[model samples]
Target: MPFALYLLALAVFVMGTSEFMLAGLLPAIAADLEVTVGTAGLLTSAFAAGMVVGAPATAAFARRWPPRLTLVACLFVFAGCHVAGALTPAFPILLATRVVAALANAGFLAVALSTATALVPPGRKGRALAVVLSGTTIATVAGVPAGALLGTGLGWRATFWAVALLCVPAAFGISRRPAGADDGSAPDLADEVRQLGSPRLVLALLLAALVNGGTFAAFTFLAPVATGVAGLGEAWIAVVLVLFGAGSFLGVVIAGRLSDRRPGLVIGVGGPLLAAGWSALALTAAHPAVFLTLALTQGGLSFAVGSTLITRVLYAATGAPTMGGAYATAALNAGAAAGPALAAAVLATGAGVTAPVWVAVALTAAALAVKFAPWWTGSRRPDPIKRPRL
Candidate 1:
């Protein structure tokens, strides 16, 4: 892989951290801002909704611009939003800043995936995308946990400041990177609409929502889950997050390799593991050992489900890589928003503590049952020789 690709990975890592760090800092934010915990949680919802809108909207607007340039602008916007978030005095101002930052994050991810695929050989595109996208997985291991610790030790504003500082150079690095190939033109609004119209693409995206929605529903509120339901406490949340990320990394690496070897097989295992992991998660607060065990198990299963889902969408989308794949990114953020929103609903009844794990169990089951009827005519040979990319 080109060194520029590693730069892409770094940018992704920072953005993922920026988007997710709020969760770790929610308690601090609630205390400092003097808001109810549920209201403070809207920050998460706002950012996620921004991504859901920004992914498609930005992709449409930037269709005529160079992908690299688009990515840089998005990164710059992301960094600036962090600064705004840090400086904002009122809760509403902070919420607004988070939304803008999330929009930038959505645009950045869509553009990054588009650029990564274009930068590689046709045969290795999947692997290239994996290499660059691994930053997200790495975030769980490093970014989210670190952000949690930073928020607890420094303050929520300090967390945003740190994210801003990290993103400044990432924007510069993106600007310096080489352009993606000119073989395929950037996708326009019409192209994106057409791609969304496809049944296959629809199923792929539905698969993303069904699987990821539940995962996020459970995991997005994880900090609270750890402390509230599991009775762990804020002092230890970061360390446990690191452990969750560790298991997640294992799943990502393994799934990437499996996609290269056999995409179909990966999907089959995805549904089963997703269910198993979340089932374990639902039982997490049942016991101390069970809580820790579920954290690791859910981490692995979620990654396996996510990686395979991305791979499946990319392989099936074929010609409309930018459009179809970008929608998947949108699904990801939308799913994130959905999970927490559902959690909030449960919290209103003072049932919030148990909401996440159970919601995750339901969503994972839905994901497993998403039954993509045999669309494949078994036309393509399952040749290990023409390996899927890294």
Candidate 2:
């Protein structure tokens, strides 16, 4: 893999941290901004909504630009949003900044994936993408916790400042590095529409949504589940998140090695394992030790299945490579938004904190069914081996 790919990973890490750090700072934000916890949570929802809209929109608009230039511009905007967020004096302003920042984040990720995969050999796209996405897992391990700590010590605004400062280095690196052969062509709207029309591509995207939605539905409420259901303290929740992050990294590495050679097998096995992990979490949420163990395993399973899902999308949407990645990002973000909303509904109904676990199971099972659909198994839709460049 090219060194530029790792620089892309650093950019991803900055973006992911900005997104996930909100979970840790919600309480502080709620208190400082004098809003209800529920209202403060909308920051997360707003960011996800922006990402869903931004990916394809950004890809469509920046299609003519080089991928490196697109990525650098996105990072610059992303950093600027954080700086604005850090200086916001009111809740609404902060929320608006999140939306704008998320838009930049979505564009950066879509372009980064295209650039990273294009730098590698055809068979190694999975691993190359993995290298870029590992930044997210690493953020979960270091960034989220560090943000929470910074918020506690220096106020929540400090966390945003830190994210903004980090983006400087990421943007600088991306600007200086060559993005290989990826011209970062803006995707044609007509071509994307035609690509979306493919049943195989549609199914692949649905699978991505389901898996991500399932994983996040449960994960969105994990800290609460740890404290309320499992009887662990706040500190322990951090440790468990670190463990989950470790599991995610492990899954990405393993899936990277297998997705190229055995996309079908990877999904077939990973989908069920993810479902099983959720089922076990549902059954054992009251047991701290058991819940922690299952959370770790579940995190890994989610990403492993995710790696294969992206590979599937690239295979199915061969006609529109950049649009395929943007679509995948959009699908996953849609799931991310939906999962928590549905899980919140379950919570509102007094279904207990463990309800998210069952939500996860159902979503993952739905994904498993989609993966095994007749259309997916037919001879006419055989998985193709040839890959696209950025």
Question: Global lDDT of each model?
Answer: 0.74, 0.85
* The best candidate in terms of TM-score: 2
- lDDT string, candidate 2, 195-270, tens digits: 9988778888899898889888988888888999899998898988898888988888898888877876778777
Q: At residue 88, what lDDT does model 1 achieve?
A: 75
Off by over 4 Å in 2: 182-188, 383-390
Q: Tell me, by lDDT, which candidate is best.
A: 2
Candidate 1 pairs with clashing backbones = 127-390, 217-339
Local accuracy of candidate 1 as per-residue lDDT tens digits, 1-390: 777777888999998887767766788888888898889988877887898998878877776677777888888888888888888778999999888888888888887776776677656555766777788878878898788778878788888898889887877887876676434365456765776665556666777777778777777666776787677867757766776777777777777676645766766766777777666666657565777777777777787767767766665556565665578788877777787677667767776477766777777676656554443323233534454421
TM-scores, all candidates, are 0.88, 0.95
- Mark the regions of model 1 whose C-alpha exceeds 4 Å error after superposition: 31-35, 182-184, 223-234, 346-352, 372-390
